[model samples]
Target: MLLEGKTVLITGASQGIGRAAAVECARAAANVAINYLGDEAEAESVVAEIRSLGREAIAIRSDVADPASAPAFVAAAVTAFGGVDVFVSNAGICPFHAFLDMPVAVLDRTMRVNLHGAYYMVQAAANQMVAQGRGGSIVAVSSISALVGGEYQTHYTPTKAGVHSLMQSCAIALGRHGIRCNSVLPGTIQTAINKDDLADPEKRARMAARIPLGRLGVPEDLAGPILFLASDMARYVTGAALLVDGGAFVNLQ
Candidate 1:
């Protein structure tokens, strides 16, 4: 029960890494607030699973890209759970497109969801945490693409990089309030967004070969690190960019 009596709000929590984190936090005895953009059923399913663990859970529908919705959702979660102990900014979009093929619309949409959305959520969460005077943890879900260029992710990578920067800045600014801010950079993970890309035998093989770990990551693989960052274990940690990349970044080939 690392997070006993704590309340955690996770965005994009309907499935994938966000969902896994929600379940893990609940198992640690934290009340969970699952936020989803569109999948009501999936969000509710996560809520049900958390409740089965004897932890309180709620499903919140919010589009992080919407500035108004970001604060609104955080406020709603506070109302539901008393106050937020952890806020995981995991909502993001990564549509691959070659640099030459990238369009303005795609770049705008990507920034809206990945960059602006994260900024708004962090601001709102920090404000609430400061107001509570209890301090809190904010974990932004970044990607290894932020550190290395992705041939097909010219626009996508920038958003993640921006998120990492945001985390650092937030960490420095929120430290005085006892708040900790950090970023988690995940490597290739088996999520619905990349299902088709990884389904290709050749693509999967090439990707696995590049990773020193010899396998792609699963959503659960990141849950533990995220939980640690959000827990008291990381009391002295802040402004850190942790790579849960399974040695992908170290594999130079």
Candidate 2:
């Protein structure tokens, strides 16, 4: 009920953290709009699930990396939901590869989707919120990788860092408009995105053991923090980088 009568727009809501956050937001009484690419069946299923929760939901297929599509996505949601109250920028991709052998295409695509996509989406959402004359919340799904380095995530981590920095700067720029911008820095969460990387049982267990929480995270593990940041409960919180990493970031021994 934290978001009763509110409206939330989420990018890449067809799966993983985005999918869980969308459902959780609906449970909190917010009508939802989801943006996805490539998977129509999966995206529509999420729409069906949200509708089942007695909350209005719509799924639009748009390439977040397409700069123009960002405004289109936000405009469609605003038209359907009347106004936008919360925006979750969560569309991203991670293609693991050695830094020395990294291909230009992979790096380009990663940056385009992870960092550029987030920027476009956030900008459009802020414009609508400003026009509405009502304060709004923006939560970008950054990653713990933003705070640290990764053997195979050289390209991806920088984009995450950029996202975190975007929130910090935007928080300052939009505060006068009553718009809050923050980011969630997630740790290793088991999802389709990294399924192949963790395919080996031994490798997966080793990764989990490094975390203080004694286990890996799931998509749902991040929903609460996201909801908190997007709700009135966090009205005083902005320009914050929340680490939803199962305490993994500080477990160095």
Candidate 3:
């Protein structure tokens, strides 16, 4: 009930963390605008789920990686819900690859989608919030990889670090307008992004064994943290990074 009557715009809501967060926010009574570039049917399902909660919901097809799409994405939300009250920059992709022979195409695309996408979306949302003169919240989904390195994720980690850093800078720049900016660093969530890697039961078990929680995270695990950051409860909280990793980050030796 924290975001009752608010308008929440989320990117990459077709699946995973974004989808979970969108549905959770709607459960809290917020109208939601979902952005997705893949699988129209998947996006529609999320919309249907949110609608079932009796909240206004719209599915917008937008690619955050495209610079021009950011403004358009926010505009679509504004058109549907009047104005943006909460913006979640959750669109990202991670292609597992070794550092030694990482292809330029993989690195460039990852940077564009994960890092640049957040930048564009956040800026667009902040501008809208500033114009509205009522302030708002922007939550970026960074990753635990931002704090730790990965042997096979050479090209992916930096973008996530950049997303976290972007939230820090945006917090300072938008603080005057009362716009709160924060980042959520999630750990090893079982999503389509890493379905291939986690498919091996032994590997997943080994990874889970290292976590203090004795399990890998799921998309729903991040929904609450994201909702908190977007709601009024975090009014005084900005320029912060909250780890939704189930104690995994601290458990590291």
Candidate 4:
């Protein structure tokens, strides 16, 4: 019960990595507020699962990129669960295409949701955490793309890189207030985000070959690290960029 009695707000909790984190948080005995942009049904389903875990849970619909909506989302969660002990900014978009071929609108949307949304969510949640006077944790989900650029993923990389920077910035700015901020950079996790490619045996094999660990990561594989960062176990750890990539980042033979 690392997070017993904790209340958490996780953005993009309808599916993929965000959804996985929501369930994991609930299993850790944390009441969860699940946020989704457009998939209400999916969000509700996740909420059901959380409730089944015997923890309080709710589904919130919000566009994290919308500054005005973000605070409201947090307020709603706090109203439901008393207060937020942890906030996980996991909402993101990946419009795959070559940088040179990317449309302005697509790029703008990506930035707004992936980078800007995170900032707004953090602000809204941090304001409450600071007022609580007990301090809290902020765990953001970044990606290894932030470390190593990928082909046709220029826009995605910048946003993920921004997350790493955001985590460090938040930790430094909020440390005096007892708030801890850290990020997890996952590599090649098998999620809906890459269903098309991963579904192809050849493509999957090719991708796995690049990872030093010899296997692709699963969403559950990330839950432990994220929970640890948000738990008392990581009290002294902040402003850190942890790579849950199973040695994928290491190229040493």
Per-model CA lDDT versus the true structure: 0.93, 0.96, 0.94, 0.91
Task: Give the candidate order by descending lDDT.
Answer: 2, 3, 1, 4
lDDT of 3 at 18: 98
Model 4 global lDDT (CA atoms, 0 to 1)? 0.91
Error of 2 at 135 (Å): 0.9
Cα RMSD of predicted structure 1 = 0.9
Error of 3 at 229 (Å): 0.6
Q: lDDT per residue, candidate 3, 39-101, as tens digits?
A: 999999999999999999998897788999999988988998899999999999999999989
Clash count, one per candidate: 0, 0, 0, 0
**TM-score computed on alpha carbons, candidate 4:** 0.97
Per-model TM values vs. the true structure: 0.98, 0.99, 0.98, 0.97
TM-score of candidate 2 relative to the true fold:
0.99
Candidate 1 lDDT: 0.93
Q: For residues 1-253, what per-residue lDDT tens digits would candidate 2 score against the true structure?
A: 9999999999999999999999999999999999999689999999999999999999999999999999999889988989999999999999999999899999999999999999999999999999999999999999999999999999999999999999999999999999999999999999888999999999999999999999999999999999999999999999999999999999989
Instruction: Check candidate 1 and list the clashing pairs.
Output: none
